[model samples]
Target: MADLAKEAASLHKAASGLRTVRQHTAKPLQEFESASHDLSALGALGSLLGAKGDIEEGMTTLVKLAKQLDEEWETEAKFMGDVSDAFDLLEVLLTAAARAEKG
Candidate 1:
């Protein structure tokens, strides 16, 4: 029971850390989109090579990927929190059941 408690504590800590990460991720992803805007200048060079369409297409793909990553990370953080809460509830129920059995 002691070891189990320790592990549960560790998991809760990790979940908290993930929630923090989820909060911080937006700024970096926004910066990434800002940087991608600078890359649009490459379109001029691509035009000379007749690859402007390809460059624009690639840029669109990159933006979509960044958005996807942001959404997925948000989802994962939510899942971690939900799982942590479930464990806490399970622990409470188990303790109650154990005490009832002893009585």
Candidate 2:
């Protein structure tokens, strides 16, 4: 009975650890931590049989990271396009002025 109590206590600790990992962390910063807990929960079915959707939750974190990357890429693309167009206009203006002086 004492051994069973110790086993139960160990299970409870693992359960508490998994919950802490899930509730306390968010994307990017908690990515690795969430993964570690998820894998542990997978190995121990007793702790994670109900939260099977955590894998999808992990994917959601990745989706957030992807969205952030897309936003940055779009910002960079717009800035580059604007700069290129400005240079084109400047070159045209400079050429027109040179022609007028030559005339």
Candidate 3:
């Protein structure tokens, strides 16, 4: 029982750290999405203007890849945050149950 409480406390601490990571990463993810949007918009404008040179084509590819990367990053961050939340809940429930059992 003591060991269980200790493990729960450790997991709670890790969840807190995970929440911090989520908060810190969110701002950078937003910036990355903004940059990706700008690049994609520019690519569309260049295409409309018949700017089909090698550099422009390369940029178009880069924009596609950037958008994909942005999406993946967003998904990953959201999952991380969700996992943190679940861990937090579990820690709370386990701690409460342990206390009740002791009483």
Question: lDDT: which candidate is best?
Answer: 1
> Considering TM-score, where higher is better, how would the candidates rank from best to worst?
1, 3, 2
Which digits, one per residue and each the tens of the lDDT, describe model 2 over residues 24-88? 44455456645645555465573457554666576667766755755555565555555545555
RMSD of 2: 24.4
lDDT of 3 by residue, 1-103 (tens): 4554565556556545644554566576567645544544546765676554544556557656755765666666566556656666776788889899999
Evaluate all candidate structures by whole-model CA lDDT and list the values in order: 0.69, 0.56, 0.60
Best-matching candidate per TM-score: 1
- TM-score of each candidate? 0.67, 0.46, 0.50
Steric clash pairs (candidate 1): none
The better candidate by TM-score, 1 or 2, is 1
Model 3: how far residue 103 lies from native, Å:
1.3
Please identify model 2 stretches exceeding 4 Å from their true place: 1-57
Model 3, position 36, has a per-residue lDDT of: 43
Model 3's TM-score against the true structure:
0.50
